[model samples]
Target chain A: MTDAVKISNRNFSVFYGAIQALRGITLDVLAHQILGIIGPAGSGKTALLRSMNRLNDLNPNCRVEGQILLDGEDIYQPEFDAVRLRKRVGMVFALPVPLPLSLFDNIVYGPRLSGIRARARLNELVERSLQAAFLWDEVKDRLQTSALRLSGGQQQRLCLARVLAMEPEVILLDEPCSGLDPISTSRIEEALMALKSKYTIVLVTNNTKQAARVADTTAFLLQGELVEVGPTDRIFTAPKDQRTNDYVSGRFG
Target chain B: MRIPPRNTQALAVTLLAGATGLTLAVLVFVIVFILGKGLPVISLGFLFDNPQEMGKAGGIFPTLVGTLILPLVAILIALPAGVGTAVYLSEYTGDNLATRIIRFGTDCLAGIPSIIFGLFGFIFFVTTLKMGWCILSGALTLAIMVLPTIIRTAEEAIRAVPAGYREVSCSLGATRWETVLKVVLPNALPGIVTGIMLSIGRCIGETAAVIFTAGASLRLPHSVFDSTRTMAVHFYILAREGISNENAYGTAAVLILSVLLVNSLSYWMMNRFIARRTK
Candidate 1:
């Protein structure tokens, strides 16, 4: 994993209407490594991930009070176009949300939105993205088939492929395998491991063991506050914070 | 004196079944009553030949043409505006006072009587505009009458599109308009079409508004500016004037059949479109 800081959150906070979801979170996600955010329910993990790409801006009640920098530039600046930023920073939601379209159409939605209308170019993207997400072989022959027909795990991976098609520099996953079988989860983990060399990945998950297994760096959040973020090995084995230690040791979520 | 759970369940089931049966019976009875009295009067000659002697002796060819042109023109005028309003209200305008007022306005418009709309069309399009009871005046009136139906149904349809689809589209860098156009609208198509179908039915059956504006001219309409007689108006004049009960029934049958044809055709097209996506 590279030691370069791809993203830096400098005392960021988020509010949904009147409720504070994240409170002064500061962290760095290094390039070419999976940064796993492990937290229990309502710990602001999703809020943090979504805010990076300004997906949270859709909510009329959403408000933010901090800066998240991408490659030394603050993304929250008024001049920073959220639409263009989303193209660079793709996201995979917690549940698989395959659009009611063919597999080919779903993968090319981002590309089409970005004005890549060449037929050959879209076809190439469909193949390569599905391959990168480890879904090409299973669905290679049925690209025109409806995406909703795919199994839950395959659908989630297809969602990942949809992001890949955008050729994004950063890939954010919010509990990508929260509802997957062990084999499916392992397959996703394997794909992520293989993908990190070319993409900066941030994985938000409830499973601590998943973080321990795949993440090079791990951050634990407790009730909307970041307890600590460190190397996964150190965070899991020798954390300096007593709360982190207790949480890692399964004392309580 | 609390009833036992099993007995209550059975009683509830019986009552629900009886209510359903009664509803179905009423619907069937109305359809049968109309078709039974109307079917014997229909003939190919009656359909193709132009009316003679104030709709006493020939076919309703002119009225059929009017029926086709009037609804077509009205739908063309209202569909874009209604759908635009629906999309803007649902996707662009957040929950605010303006949106609420617009929604309430649509509801009020929907609640207004067809006779009232006829009066407005007569006063506004026919008299004030000096359009003189032509197809344009009638169609404009019908368009206003159907706008609320199309807007309300299209809004419901657009809102029914899963919130997740919008999120996915936005996250993939789609602009609000792009998301609405590509994702939300296509998924909402079946519902929008259903709303359109309902509007078409209302336009085909509407007598009050069309009579007030279009002026029951038995002559075939040459253009939007030409005053014409629609199927409903022809039927009303025939039955009311006691011109020919036989011809009136024939027009009624033709009206029923055309509405059915349009409805089934739209449904078939919609089903095929939906099937293609699923496959």
Candidate 2:
């Protein structure tokens, strides 16, 4: 991965009404790297990830202070188009919510909204996206069938394929494999590894093992505060913070 | 052998079953009585022929036509307006004071008496708008009456759509309107159709509102501007005026049959649509 920063948050703080979810957090997310954020519940991992693409703006009471930059540009600027920003940075939620549509249609939904109307192009895009998510082989024969019929793991992968179909530069995943079985989780991890060459990935996971397995860089957040961030091996083997060492070693959350 | 104490639960169950049986018996008896009295008078000649001697001697063909037309026009006016309001209230707005007030207003509208709506329609459509005592005026009145039902039901349906769909759509960069149009509406369609079916039933049976806005003219309406009478109004006048209880019973039977037919057809269509969607 290049050392070029794709997204940077400087003194970023988030508040849901009066309750602050994320304290002042400053971090640089480099291009083409998997930045795994390991945190316990209520550590603001989701807030930080959502703030990158302005998804937190959906909450009326959510307030953001400080700058979140995407590709060296302020994403929270008055003139920044959220719709366009979202197109550049896509997200997959914890629960796999496949649009109540056909498998083919779900993949094409993003492109169709962006006005890609050509049949041949959409067909090519759907195939490529599903392949990237490692779902093509399983669903190729029944692309027209309802996406809801897929297994839980396949649904999660389908969601990943949906984001990939948008041709986004970055992907934000919020505990994407939290509900998946080990086999499904491994498949998703494998897909992410293959996907890192083309897309920057930010994964917020409660499972430290998942971070260890897939991430290049790891950041530990505790109680809305960033305790430490470093290379995965170093963070795992030689954490500087006592809390990180304690949490990673299963002493306490 | 165990001695059973006083079985209060069994007694209560028996009482409840008896009440239910009595209610069903009454309903069946009324239906049977109506059919027996009205069947002989319901010949093709009695059905299709025009009324003679002020609806005392002839068929209710014109009344049947008016009954069909008035409700059709009412549904046409109310469905779009009601569903649109429902979508806006449920989907576009937040749960602020304004939305709460609007919901309150809708509930108040639902509770208002049909007679009051008839009076308002008479003053507004019949006099102020000069629509006259015609089908259009009646339809407009009934539209207002049924609007609340449609709005409430449609709102519930729209709200029942899981919030996850909206989030997913937004994450994919779809605009709010696109998500609503492509996802929300399609998922809420069956419920909306159910609300409309209820509205149709209410429109068919409504007499007070139709009587005030649509004059009891015993003739087929040539246009919306023409005065007409519905089956319910015709039945009411026949029975009240003591002209022919026979024709009144016949009209009642026909109304019930028509309502059954409509309900069955709509349910069948809805089931087919849902089946195809899932398939």
Which whole-number lDDT from 0 to 100 does residue B73 have in model 1? 95
Give the 10-residue window scoring lowest on summed lDDT in candidate 2 chain A: A52-61
B1-279 per-residue lDDT for model 2 (tens digits): 644556777788899999999999999998899888887778787778898887789898999899899999999999999999999998777799998998899899999999999999999999999889999999999999999999999999999999999888888998889889988988898899899999999999998999999989997889999999999999999999998888889888888888988889988998887666655
Q: Residue A227 deviation, candidate 2, in Å?
A: 1.6
State the displacement of the C-alpha of residue B138, model 2, in Å, after optimal TM-score superposition: 1.3
Model 2 - which docking category? Answer: medium
Best by TM-score: 1
For B53-164, candidate 1 gives per-residue lDDT tens digits of: 9988988899999999999999999999999999999998799999999999999999898989999999999899899989999999999999999999999999999999
**Each prediction's Cα RMSD?**
1.4, 2.6
- Residue B184 CA displacement from its true place in model 1, Å: 0.5
What is the iRMS for every candidate structure?
0.8, 1.2
